[model samples]
Target: MTPPTRPDIIQWIKRAWASLTTATILGGFKKARILEAGQAEHELSHSEPDWKALICLLQQGNVPVQTIDSSKDIKQDDAVEEDDEVVNGVFD
Candidate 1:
């Protein structure tokens, strides 16, 4: 099979980033509720600087940085075509 194209990689990154941001927002809300109940502050595993560093690394590698519009839904066709290979490569 041919290697994934640049558009495929960009779409994959965008989907992954969208998932990451959604999870982060939900987690923050959960933590806020816990704090309101008088629980101790929840420590974040990843800090803002860590995320920034990740973006910086991507930019340094010449990856185009595109702003995601959370208001719009990402179409199914825009998702990575080589999902299994990409996911396995990242995890394994």
Candidate 2:
């Protein structure tokens, strides 16, 4: 395969960072969490950039993906004005 261009490499790294962080935040203290913690720690490391961390993620290929279902629902939510506070949380 053709070598990835510099831009592609950078894009991949950014995507990897976002994905790793997301997995960590949602996965908590599972194996993915451990991996995410380590990966992020290495990335916030220096001035130039950490290509090694991205390469490691790509090489290891065990990042757990959290499946999120796309959804949208319309609903009305209200309780009451308990102590005369303005009910301005949503526009009716």
Candidate 3:
């Protein structure tokens, strides 16, 4: 695979940072009882561009993270695509 360019890397960093920030805030809200557990989990899970590998990359790069206010909400569209490989046509 071809290596990503500088701009590409920067974009990924921005997206990853947003995801991490959202997760952090939501997690705190859940712990503090400010938000319900299911609501927190759903918001955290649905964040577009949320990638575990990106978080590791940021840590490896020694990026310092700042906490965001839990009262603020981060909303983004779903990033995942439909998968035809998940199932086949079933008998009627």
- Highest-lDDT candidate: 3
Per-residue lDDT tens digits for candidate 2, residues 29-72, read 33644345444442244343356654565456665655443243
Q: How many residue pairs clash in all the candidates, one count each?
A: 0, 0, 0
Off by over 4 Å in 2: 22-92
Candidate 3 ranges with C-alpha deviation above 4 Å? 22-92
Highest-scoring model, TM-score: 1
TM-score of each: 0.27, 0.24, 0.25
What is the lDDT for 78 in model 2? 34
List lDDT for all candidates, in order: 0.53, 0.48, 0.54
Ranking by TM-score: 1, 3, 2
For residues 1-92, could you state the per-residue lDDT of candidate 3 as single tens digits?
23455577779877766656666855665576655677525334454544664464456546675675534533232222344234455322
Better of 2 and 3 by lDDT: 3
Residue-wise C-alpha lDDT for candidate 1, range 9-90, written one tens digit per residue: 8788766655575347445644644223343433335433245544654565566988866456455555555544645456
Worst 10 residues of 2 by lDDT: 70-79
